[model samples]
Target chain A: MQQVQQQTTSDPILEIRGLTQNFGGLRAVSDFNVTLAGKQLTGLIGPNGAGKTTVFNLVSGFYQPSEGQILVDGVPTAGLKPHKVTALGVARTFQNIRLWNDMSVMDNIRVAQHYRLGYGFFHSAVRSKRYRQREEEIAREATELLEIFELKKYADEYPRNLPYGTQRKLEIARALSIHPKLLLLDEPAAGLNSSDIHELIRLIRWIHDRFDVTIWMIEHHMDVMMELCTHIKVIDFGQTIAEGTPDDIRNHPAVVTAYLGDDKI
Target chain B: MLRRYSVHLILATLGGLVVYLAYNEYLGLYYLSVLMFMGVNIILSSSLNLVNGYMGEFSCGHAGFMCVGAYVASVLGVWLFARDRVFGAPVLDPEYALYAFPVIILAGGIAAALAGLLVAFPSYKTRGDYLAIITIAANYIIISAIENMSAIGGSRGFMGMKGVINAMEDTIYLPWMPIWVFIFTIFSVWVIRRYVSSTFGKGVNAISQDEVAAEIMSVNTNKIKTITFMLSSGLAGIGGGLFAYILGYVNPGSFNILKSTEIMVMVYLGGMGSLSGSILAAILFTILLELLRPLQIIKWIVIPLVLIILMQFRPEGIMGNRELGQTFPRLKKFYRFK
Candidate 1:
């Protein structure tokens, strides 16, 4: 078994030290630790119900960790709410694609910037000059982001009407609109066809290089993880089983046993 | 920019025409009262729609906030501008009532907004039917609190607001209540439109659609919920203030569960999340209520039956969350809401 050691990065974007989570008496995640830095792309892989999402949920502040510390850019996120955590430059997408289905695509992108709206109820109610200027800037930025993702044509359409692949791309684009320092994507290729999967792989790689943001993804698809992730971490029953470069993880006996089970049986 | 504001200009002209008709006595007292009630209903439904439709919270105690507004505004107006048995002489000159009418209504709204915290705080943990139960209980609590206050006439009701209205008319020979109602109705709708169209306010929609996504995506769900409940209840308070002045009295029994249910019916009839839909539904519902006045007690039964049939055929309501412009695209050229 690989030892639980932190990555030696001088400037880490996300640092989790001995993070643990419990649902009643059941241990969902136990003593999880990881340090992601720079613009590195990492993969987290495990079987269903293996606490992969619980890790993302803990990092995103959806659930407070039972123990340990999470530092985003040197700030502890112990009691900060999810939106406050997002304000500190962390953004994420759901495994099931949780876009605001009723809102139009343009609004979906615009609303994600709610953290830095820089205005309030009175400004909006009175339509102050600052409110008007900020709104214009937000609209312009949203349009540009949509155009970059080639989603400008569907700007006025509701998200529910979009095809499955387009919806996934829109969700990723929405997360990036917040200008996150770290983007956590939970299975971007889960529901996409083979062609869409290829497009998504290219899209994610381009986003990593273009946006200068660290990416941490969770996926069950082996080919996508092998092709995209430079480093891989495998967990089973909420315990870290192996951690290394993707090639090393591929050859690790612990990971093989965790995924395929005992051959002697 | 000019094209964007053209709609406001057109509405202003329409408002001026109504005031002119009222001044010339072209519309009688009966018609004028109907028009004023329309304005009041418009404020009530649109405000409730902010919470129920846009924010997707089932708030059944809207009249509780309205009751708070009505009592606060009535007592303040009587104490400040009129002679009453409860409070000897007027604090300010009766003539100031004309100038301070808007202030009185706004004061009512602010008081109601503070009362809205009763529900907003609980909403942090509970939602859906649980929140609905809290709101319903809050409605009872507010009504019971006012009903037990013997100083304000309690169950018997309170009056002397007519003196305040008379003081205002004595200052100017205009139909002051109609004018104020029209102005505040338009103001409330304008504020709501501006709020919902802005990115900050779209957080309400985000919360309604998927609160988890909203919270994780940087929308402060709790703060948004608080602001929405306050704004919604505050506007309902304004509506209640107007209703009290129009009728020249305040009573706890008037702002009861039945009244709250009426406002909800108007919201559902209009379609949730559409300001234009709320306004249209309010106007139609008001006229329907007035027309069916002859039915008296039977009207309640008939109205619910109509709503039931409406639900069976068009469950999403008349506009189905689309604005007037979206329902009829030709209206877009004249003015775009966003």
Candidate 2:
């Protein structure tokens, strides 16, 4: 709850400078950069295999960049593991919606708060007051988060049993369980129906307004991005081609060419 | 809060009853040995369950840790507390053995845990079949190392712990072996049950489910693996200590690949991710082992054949990741999430 508490600051919540990732001989993400301010819902759009997911991987600490630095709240995360990066107030959902599918939906969310737990193993073994207090708090907070996503009904069910859209929403809810300052969504709307997309857009906007977190999403759906994102960045072949407001990105020559396969625009 | 305290109270009373029965000779020697075997299997299977079941990693070399614990405890028992045929007189008088017994067992656990690090660190870089190989190698290495240690009687193996256990008996008039075995068995299950139910323990489940997602969610997968392995191996060490005391002798041959396989069979039979299942399966497995003693070498063949048939019919094992409470509605009231 302390992490979700709003702190007004002029500083950007995330700043990636000269980030580049090379997988063997191929340059997957070349010199990618972005500065995300707190509470901003930004979009990153590109064609398939445009290194968008690779960029997400690098920023999220799934892969160490061959070149560049990622600063979360102005701290370097070059050598840190993904979990350590997450502990520094960054959380992410996968492109394929990776939830702890065997665990109940409520457990999926509660498990994300592993680091936030203050009690030691001995304390829990003895069922000390501190363990009971912390556990009760986690259960309460997880249930509240599930309710926000309209997932209270499925709390006892495993994530694998949930509908696809609900699973996606649950993944987002799990990410939010970290009470992170920054959230990275990789292809959030990749396989959703249009109605689900609309609901997702509404949910994203609601989250941007309600939670004190910066949101950077990789979305293939242009309508969702145009409808929800305040700023948009376009990439092609691992290179950033344009960055500006959604309208500006939509009109940029390189951006239109990258998506439509044309330079005459 | 009252329910929690009552649970502990009930457990304590039950434990007291079992210890009392064994100490007073109300139970025959053969039955007592069988009960003690059940306790050791409970410790072994449940500890292995922490890694292979709850953590969702395959480790087949668990007996190696048991060997380490058994040897360390045996040596320390002779050197510090008791006289022996091979090792001569104790460095200290037998009067101190009642206190020294636990310290020796704990030392064994610590040593086994240190040995566990060898496998745990390598596990970070590998998984599945490769991890299995690593664990197998670790098992062989521990056995071979012990066999080669001439100072500890090498391949002839060592015998001396009977003197130490007897010293403890002389110090306190109670049934030392059964009582200690009972206490350690409860401690093992309690530690594991408490672990898998806690928030940090949930990280182990998360790693088992999806390592990448768990990492992005701030579950330290590497650290969790290390801790789980150490805890698992440490408990196995305690089981080994109890085993050495019960047998009054130990050999590298006793803690071999076959021993590890038996523990693995118990884990799968119990079902993965269910602590109660592990405990139940261990009891049944120990009983089966006892019943099969007349079968000689044929017991191994029959055991695996039964396991194969069981896999065909119910591949998830008896509990199949569901606890006894999940299957029986009447038992639900007694179920705590841990």
Candidate 3:
């Protein structure tokens, strides 16, 4: 018994439509549409100038869409801030590796779980059993998150001391601390070494399969895109030019030109 | 996990020292006054530390809160001390005046906390240079408002704390204002040190690191600002309460922008997040000023030149955000018992 959705029947955990985003005079993203189904790893690929990160910003509410609709789990979130979007179960990492550099790695992860902590002064100051319990719970969770990202050895170390690749993994572990249903990773593999990128691809695939989360990642890595992504969306400047399996994205002439300078193919 | 017995051990040592000092009443008075100054500096640094160190917001108006606390406490002290004297008889006999000290200081703390609430609101709305102006404005407002109030010896200043001390002397045959000032100073430091290590305190540090991230993670930043401001002001008020008693006078002229600047200097010099740094700075700063006072006007030139030199080498100030124990970890067990 197949049911017809009033809109689309893709059963998307996240859906964006006609999202127009302007940065001062530049229309960074225009007529952007994306749908992410549950537990699917989707790639958002294009040339450097394409609106991939802009779309993440628009969806994350860092930049307000010039005009459009953003729906998370079928709920409209057109006018909201980043934290508000985060509260609605959409967590993101940054392209520039936005982290609390002075803080310990464990603190970075614990900070994300702040919303989950229910203890106030009465519970915290009085050392009530609940506070102690919650404290232990968060520590355990932070440890597990560190283990997942393979950053347990650097848990107590500050971000400034860690290697660049480890810092990026720490950033993802921090995002995972929020337990988001939809993860928006903006160029997670941007500056990773070859070995680290291999681990990242495996990790990203693992997270999708295990957590039942929909991952929408902006990346320029063809190998990562070809390896992990079930489907790919290709955009040029501000408009989507192609949407299909990875094979379709590879063959699309506009996406091809956007990357190779000219369609030699 | 820290124990009360550990606190008592440190207290007993300080208490033994205070007893030894009390044998010489004249020197005891000087020591008590210095101790009071040290306490005030602790409050100044610790509260400002909440903004400047733990919270990472630059504020320059500690003196304003001190003024607010001072006037409020002084007015209450005068009102209570005046008693039937308002009807021109002085309802509270001189003998009992010493006992009223705590009440007057509490009123000051509450009044200053209210004033702190005002500063906290504006702080949330602005940062950097804009916040600096707001603090400067607050300082001016407190000063002018105090000067305008003619009822309490406006510009010429007010006295009578000496009378209270005199009363206590008559009652107990005490040696120079008792040992409570030293006790309170130690207590203030201990409380702040303990609070800073707690969960609520970490939130302050988290805010200093990244505010947007803090809010997204549910740090309740606005509420923290309000509470932290109130707390710092309350501590400043405690300092004022002690200052009033120490000098045996209350004066608006003494609590000005310059005074606020002095507190700021102490906080920065001590190291923003370091409690022990402030405590040490307070002691050193007071001793430095006293030692330099013999140089009179020339002291200003030498001190500023030295400070500028110090700044070049240590931009984060003498302690540079590290606590005494952090800098000298070997002292941990002996220095802070708990």
Scored by TM-score, the top model is 1
Pitting candidate 1 against candidate 3, the one with the higher TM-score is: 1
Better candidate by TM-score, 2 or 3: 2
lDDT of 1 by residue, B1-338 (tens): 76799978887897888889999999898999999999999999999999999999999999999999999999999999999999979999998999999999999999999999999999999999999999999999999999999999998899999999999989998889888998999889989998999999999999999999999999999999999999999999999999999999888999899999999999999999988889999999999999999999999999999899989999888888999988899977778554
| Candidate 2, A81-191: lDDT as tens digits | 988899999989988888998999989999999878887667877889999999999999999999988899999999888889989999999999999999999989878
What lDDT is reached at residue A132 by model 1?
94
Q: Which stretches of candidate 1 lie over 4 Å from their true place?
A: A1-9, B1-6, B336-338
DockQ of each: 0.86, 0.72, 0.32
True contacts kept of 1: 0.93
True-structure RMSD, every candidate: 3.2, 3.0, 4.4
Tell me the lDDT of candidate 1.
Answer: 0.93
- Chain B structural similarity as TM-score, candidate 1: 0.97
Query: What is the C-alpha local distance difference test score of candidate 3?
Result: 0.74
Q: B173, model 1: CA deviation in Å?
A: 1.7
Per-residue CA lDDT of model 3 for B95-212, tens digit only, reads 6666776667777877887887768898777877887788788878887888887777777776666655666677776544445456556655655554455455566677777776
Which docking category, incorrect, acceptable, medium or high, applies to candidate 2?
A: medium
Quote the positional error of residue A172 for candidate 1 in Å: 0.3
- Model 1 residue B71 distance off true place after TM-score fit, in angstroms: 0.6
TM-score of chain B of 3: 0.90
Range of the 10 consecutive residues with the lowest summed lDDT in candidate 2 chain A:
A1-10
Worst 10 residues of 3 chain A by lDDT: A1-10
